[model samples]
Target chain A: MNKYWHVVGVGIQNTLVYRVNFLFRACFALIPLMATIYLWRAIFASNADSPQIAGYSLATMTSYYLLATIVDALTAVAEDDWQIAADIKDGRISQFLLKPIDYLAYRLCLFGAGRIIYAAVAALPATLFIVVQRSHFLLPSDGLTLVLFLASTVLTALLQFLMSYTIALLAFWVLEVSTFIFILFAFEYIAGGHLFPLDILPSALANALSYTPFPYQLYFPVSIYLGRIAGDELWRGLLIQSFWVATLFGLARFAWHRGIRRYAAVGG
Target chain B: MNASSHSRAFAGWGLLRRYARLYGALWRNSVVREMGFKTNFVLWIFVEMLWFALQIAFIAVIYQHTDRIATWSKWQVVMLIGASHFIQQVFTAVFLLNCSNLSELVRTGRLDFLLLLPINTRFLVSFRQVDLGAFVNAASAVAVMIYAARQLDLEPGIVQVLAFLALCVAGVLIHYFLMFLLATICFWTVRAQGIVWGYYNLFTVARLPDGAFRPGVFKTVFTLALPMLLVSNVPVKLLVGMLESPLEIALLLGMACVCFVISEAGWRASVRQYTSAGS
Candidate 1:
């Protein structure tokens, strides 16, 4: 346990050295926030007299996007699986395999470290900036809802990591894993509700997505923060996310085993 | 001077053939690499299909609430989305796969070998690696565009089709230049991979209907300064007979030309700054 903590500490320290990279990442994360502001401003301008859409007021929607931006920043998994694949390809994994530490734990520690650094430097600042600039849109509401939002956000991150890791394991068989990564990224834009709220989805499609786990990874957490999902809906969403974590965990383990068995380190 | 000019033209043609051959070889190797894990390749196709379905589903949901987005009708928006994906695929196919590899080349000093070659180093490096897998996405997007057009019952005239094709080509050029400009920044900052990722986020705004943005400062910025909307919005509008103004077409062409020149100059500057991996 202490060893794991030590590893995590080291990981955090390592990430802090690359401060500029993290800042750039945070800046990039703001693109969605900017787009949403521009889009909602247009919508509000068009419907100046009518600010409400479905249950959300224009201010609520804007705040939702602002909160969603921070959620996205904190919850988004590491983007580079190519590095891991390269490690496996180049026999670097053999070094890890021989180490006393668990490879999975090390990778998780590294990711957590990066996320922790980002949360401190970028996500928090961006969230504060949004609140400061758009304080008028922020509705003072429930502490309970905020707690649920944080829980859902952490679970979403775990599920996202599991999904990505499962996909990355395909590098064992595939010479290049970039195409798979691209496809995953494209899916995240639509199903993960990064582009728009799932509430705005058509009934048939929303129903279909509800049966799947993609929304729980992003939409559920964002909805919680926005106070769009409450009480029974929040609990149900958490339960769904837990189930996804378990299922994806199983799949990730299976892939890792099968993949690692086939992985012939090509270079020293 | 005349004889030297003729030889240069002949050399240029020979270099083009060599690059073509290299591209063909890369394509074949990529196919074989993919075929080695046939199931994975098939799974990738399904994954892409899933994305297409989700995009259509999102559009459908939005259209159900409102008949129009900005000034774009449901069909027009759908066509635009498909066209943007088609244009995106062309960039993914031609340049994106190689951009990451170029960083690796610079890191490994393999770039020196390319520079020492008789061929144009820029051309060789740019086209050396191609993502043939993106062809599937391109084909699917084109099919979606054709179907969307038919569903809208829009019969494009010859001139419109020609303009659409021209705009698509220009879109590809603009995308290439924009990406190359970003990638060239890597020469200065060795680990500018985040810039590539950040640039894609910019495309998220671009993929949406340009009509959603009011004709103001923002519109001018997007249409001229950044020109993301010109990548697909203009092309789709022309095909749907919505863009009739000569000014709009000229603006798109002008933006493409500017991006091309800026990106070319940036590439040359980056090359000059490059001192090979160890140095």
Candidate 2:
């Protein structure tokens, strides 16, 4: 446990080294957010027939994107998957195998530390953007929603990390896994509600997406924040998210066990 | 023409021919390299195709509720998005990878080798690698454009198509110069990937309808300053017959020229600032 705490400390220092990178990334993301806000504003403006399209008023839709950005900032895997893939491909994981360390636990610590630094770095810009659009930004209506949203977001971060780690484990078999990563990312981008809220899709399509882990990765938490799912539905959604987390955890462990059997290190 | 001027013109033409042949060699080298990673190459094309399909799907979803978005019909908006994708893919095919790699070159001091080469350093650095995979996505974008044209019931003449292609070249040039300018920031910093990627994200603004932005600071900045709006909007407008004046086309061409000049100057300045990464 102390060793893992040391890993977290080291990870925090490593992440801080790229503080400038994080700052610029967080600042520049506002450009696309501006476009999305304007695009939605235009969409809502064009529809004179009703104040809501797919049950999203302009204000609520605006909040959706803002919250989505915040959620993404908190949970995005960024290049961790690629780094993991590289470690496997280049024989760096051999060190972990020989040492008394669990690679998955070590990576989870690094991810947690990275996210803590990243979300802190991004908070300023995100707050500024939200403040600038304060009229449209919505907070949770009640204390339970806030607590549940926080709980679900932690699950989301774990689920995202586990899924990415599992995919990166494919490096044990394939020479290149970037395309696979990107293909998954595209699905996650659209299905996870990064591009837009899944609720905007037809009910059948939206309902179908809810069963996928992609939605649980992002949309579920953001929706919880929006109070879109409530009472029985909220509890059921959290339960589903937990199930996916547990399932992916098992899958990740299984992949690591199998992959280690065939792993070979070339360099001393 | 005077004899000296004639000799000067001949020498310039000779330089252009040599550079063209050099570019051909670079493209060949990149093709060979890409072939070495065959699965990666094919999968990238498939990944990009999935992304482009999602863009169209998102448009379809939007149009399901509203008839028009800021004066753009469903098909017209599709055309606009397709045009943006077309420009982006072409730019990616030709120059995107090379520009993105500039930071790595600077970091490793591999740029020293390029600077020592006999050829023009900027040309060599900017056009050294092409991603043939992106051209496959470019073809998919053209397919969407054709489908959108069919839905709009428009029959564009040869001249219209040629003009659209010409403007797309201008659009690609604009993106190349903008990205090159951004990447040249690598000379001043250890790494400028974040900033370059930020500019790439900013290019998403090109896909939205120009009419969506109200005339104000946002409009002025993206139009005349960065010129994101002009990249695809002006070309698509001409193709869809929404072009109100010849001046819009003129503005786009003129902006392309301005961007080129600025990018060239910035690259030169950054090169002057470059101190090789030493042991």
Candidate 3:
């Protein structure tokens, strides 16, 4: 356990050394922010006098998107899994196999470390910008709401990690995973509510997505932050997220074992 | 003919043939490779379907709130989305994915081999890796366009269809130039992976409707600084009669030409700066 924490520390230090690269990444994440602002501004302009659409005011929508951007930054995970799969294909996983550390734990540590540093340096500042610029937009009515929002954000990060890692592990079987990943990313933009609120989805599609884990990974957390979900609904959302995390965790383990068996048989 | 004009024409034709050959080979290889991964192909098809579903859901949601978005009706917006996808597919199939890998080629000195080829280096490098799978998406986009046109209950005249196709080609050109202009920066910055990622971020703006940007600084930036609107929006508008002014069509063509010239200059400068990893 201590060793895992030490690995996380090392990862954090390593990321700090490349701080400028991380800043560039944060800036890149802001592209959607610019897009959303333009989108909502147009929405408002079209209606002109209307204060609401689909039960969300322009201010609320703006805040939702702003928080979505911050949530996206905080959930940033390692890109090493695809590289790991490539390395495994090339028989380079042996280097990690020879190490004293557990490979999965090491990856988690590194991801945790990067996320911690990123949250502080990038996510925090971006969130602060949102809070300052759109203070009036937030409807944080109580302390419990704030606490639930924070918890949901943390769970959101873990759920996203599991989902991405699971997809990355598919590379063990797939010739190349870029196309699959691109498609998954496109789905994430819509289903995860990063591009727009899931409430905007058609009733049929919205009901379908509720059964999936994508909404919990992004939409649930931002909804909590925006005071859209409350009381029993908030708890229900968290339970769904927790269930997904556990389910995905089991699937990831299965994938890793099967992938490694294949790797060994192929002489990786 | 003058010697210069004759040589220029000859060189252009030669370059075109060389790129076509290389693109053909890459497309064939990619198809064979993807076919071998049967499971992946099936999964990828499903994923593409899911993407189309998601886009449909977005349109559904927008329509739920209002009868129209900006000056365009729901069907018109859907057509625009289809046009955007078409432009994206064409560019991705030919150039976008290849340009994104420029940094790796530069770092490993594979770029030297490409440079040594007898063909024009820019033409060759830009079109080397063809993603044949994008054809699936392109076909899907065309289907969506037809469906949206049907929903609108309008059959575009032959002249309008031809103009739309021309503008779509111009849109693909603008997209290629923007991507290449950014990719060429790899020559100076060896670690341009972030910049490549940043360039995709610019696509988010391109994906949204042009009218989503109000007439102000945002419009100015999209039109002049990045030209994101001209890539898909204007072309789709022209098809739908939302933009019927002759001047608008002329301006879009002019923008495409200017972007190509700027990107060509940038590519030449970057090539000059390319000191191969090998001696």
Best by TM-score: 2
* Candidate 2: stretches off by over 4 Å: none
- lDDT of each candidate versus the true structure: 0.78, 0.91, 0.79
What lDDT tens digits, residue by residue, belong to model 2 across residues A23-129?
Answer: 99998888888998998888889987799998888988899999889988899898789999999988899999889999999999999999999999999999988
lDDT of 1: 0.78
Q: Is the docking of candidate 1 incorrect, acceptable, medium or high quality?
A: acceptable
Tens digits of lDDT, candidate 3, A38-147: 67767777887778887888788888888787787778555655665566666766777687876666777777788877777786558665765664367677888888
DockQ of each: 0.41, 0.80, 0.54
Give the TM-score of candidate 3 (chain A). 0.91
For candidate 3, give the lDDT.
0.79
Whole-model lDDT for model 2 versus the true structure? 0.91
lDDT of 3 by residue, B44-94 (tens): 666766776676667767777876566767888888888888888888788
lDDT by residue (B1-279, candidate 2, tens digit) is 699999999999999999999989998999899999888888899999998888888889888888888899999999999999999999999999889999999999899999999988988888989999999899999999999999999999999999999999999999999999999999999778888888877778999899899998888989998999999999999999998899999999999999999999999899998998952
User: Model 3: which residue pairs collide?
Assistant: none
> Which residue pairs collide, candidate 2?
none
* CAPRI tier for the interface of model 2: high
Clashing pairs in 1: none
Give a tens-digit lDDT track for model 1, residues B1-279: 999999999999987788788778877877777777776666766776677666677677656555556567778878987988888878888888677566777877788999998777878777776666678888999899999999999888888888798889898888888887888888887887777767787666667777677787656777888898778988888888777686778888999999989989999999998999874
